[model samples]
Target: MDTPQNTALMRALTELPGPLPARGVIHIAIRHTDRFTVVSNDLAQHPTLSTVAVGLAVRIQSLPQGTEIGIKALAARFPEGEKLIAAALRELEAHGYLQRARTRLPNGRIVTRTVFCNQPAALLRTRVAAARPQQPPAPPQAPALPDVQQEQAPEAPAPQDHAPFVALVPPPTAPRQPSPPLPQPRELTAELDRAATALLSDLRRHASQLVLSESDVRQLAPAVAAWLERDTHPDTIRHTLTNDLPQPLRHPAKLLKHRLTVLLPPPLPGADDLAAPARPRIAVTPFQTCDGCERAFRAPTPGHCRDCRNAHGPAQAAAA
Candidate 1:
């Protein structure tokens, strides 16, 4: 039973803070009395991992092509530093959330690439259909260069043609940097946001487990689509979400998910049964303790017998 306000989700994260990164754009930063958690949206099947993965993935949707991102560049966005990503990547590999493919860069350095594909099975085809390579905006037609008519006149008849002093010189130009292409279209940003939110909702419903590599949690939607549509191979989902995607789409979800992955514990031996699941620690007041300072507090709640909870807030207990 998943819902918009899933208590189980909150409890799960509060207990296992390791997988989530404490900070970063593509991570989830969850602070508790004990420590921090970082989760990775780039990893697959990340269950109990934070939902922040979706927005972060979408955020990296429009990175410029030919740019290779590393851990340092990633740290600028989310709290999940490079170390956590390395760990998450391995964890995801273990869970089959991502497939690790090594590529030889132009400099001959081998680098691993991860793909993210977290769409629902039913919608994967639709998503892939939508994810076809889109052309970048047409450079605004170079503003037409204000085509000025030079009106070249015969050399001998120049006296009658504006005193023949017309020279074919270009007009004084405005500053070259045209204000950075108007910061992209607001409509496009909103569109991506809508798409990301929808995909996120779909993911929350379909993902049964989370995939982690080292520690980054990859979403499973794009993978679903890839599995269904060979034409839209999901080879780049991982890197796109982590380093190549644009802004807006990679909002809080991914950043939060990354934060969650940081809190994951080391792998247990054998067939995964030894891996005990974490449980939430809720502070409860005992039924028979002093009402004043409910130490393990034995006062019946709502009785106002003695704890500061009666006087102050429900979270803190003190003598009344």
Candidate 2:
């Protein structure tokens, strides 16, 4: 039975890219299970992390603190190169093993930094945290009033005065004229109306079995307009609705509406689909070599490999 840890280890080891044939020599970095932080097996089962991503997680866990790492550098070390590395870095960042941000200094210099982590930390950001909204102060309480009665105190005697007055009524004003009606907003442009009619005509022409009423065309017109608003070509819309339609259709309009609303791809962002600027490539390892055995390790160790450490007698003392 293969455990999750063993499976992940085997996967990382196998997926790492082979060195170029004429590169003279290939350098491999090794990590001891007892030396560095232990990663959870749950990361291997992560939905977004690919094989390359798993490899990267293993490599990154062995790196020293504050070691400068980048996608380009990791790509060089991993198989299938740049694009794969870029995607894997993105996956790692999403999973909280890595964070990247572009920072501007007081001197107006801007720099991009990638942070690698053995544990989850707060996400990095180029923008500062939003200031919390200020709360209003509580209203002051009113003083309590004692009960008093003015009605029981006193009453003045009433005096009578007699006078004759006549009532007057104002003349009626002339009848008001009715205001002119405001023009209603046009729901569809003339070109759009024409295109919608053309679309309906094509639908009726191709799927003659579908019974389309006037109301059905009216309802489907706006949906077609929405697809056009999303930058779908009118001809493409026409063909999509017309082709691959089921024979002896019961409700054509409903079917087309479902496809138009549900199947439409979201509008692409300008140039690239990503919301942030593309991350630049950086080196993943610090490139340190052991002093005793002359073996290159992912990060700086105690000047020796595990074998050298044991031979040098420090391992036993450290254990003690």
Across residues 89-117, which tens digit of lDDT does each residue of candidate 1 receive?
45444543334455445543447565533
User: Which candidate number maximizes TM-score?
Assistant: 2
Model 1, which residues run further than 4 Å from truth?
1-47, 51-56, 62-67, 87-98, 105-107, 118-320
Candidate 2 global CA lDDT score = 0.64
| Per-residue lDDT of candidate 2, residues 1-320 (tens digit) | 66998887776666669743565644445766677667767665666678788878888787776665676666665565777777888888888787786654444344667766544522222111222455799899897564475335354877775332221212134366563331121356676766776687567666676557888777777667656656678778877677666545677876676566546555546766556877899868666678887887666444677667678797678789
* Clash number for each model: 119, 2
TM-score of each: 0.20, 0.28
List residue ranges in candidate 2 displaced over 4 A: 1-188, 272-320
